[model samples]
Target: MPFTAGRGDASEEQTDVESFEALEPVSEVSEIFIKMDFRSFRGNVA
Candidate 1:
């Protein structure tokens, strides 16, 4: 699977993983980052 961070941003973080075992940690960490970003954005908007 392939993933990218930050829409329309040139300096974005990205990753690709070929195996399920290798992808597990990446997926977990990605979920955590997404949640954190969402919370921070919500705080900014509120």
Candidate 2:
């Protein structure tokens, strides 16, 4: 149950990916961000 899933659109997810990709140079931070973001995407939002 992703926030994106409920929205039924690719635009929002694309923006999120673009934002995450902007952090690509920061491996450690990006990994952490991706992990936390993954959980958040899976609905562990808080």
Number of the top candidate by lDDT? Answer: 2
Q: Write the per-residue lDDT of candidate 1 for residues 1-46, one digit (tens) a residue.
A: 9876555633323533343343344346446556455545544552
**Tens-place lDDT digits, model 2, residues 1-46:** 6354454555664656666665456456446657556645545545
After superposing candidate 1, which stretches have Cα over 4 Å from the reference?
A: 1-27, 38-46
Residue runs of model 2 more than 4 Å from their true location after superposition: 1-27, 38-46
The lDDT of model 1 is: 0.48
Candidate 2, residue 10: the lDDT equals 58
lDDT of model 1, residue 2: 82
Instruction: Give, for candidate 1, the lowest lDDT window spanning 10 residues.
Output: 11-20
lDDT of each: 0.48, 0.56
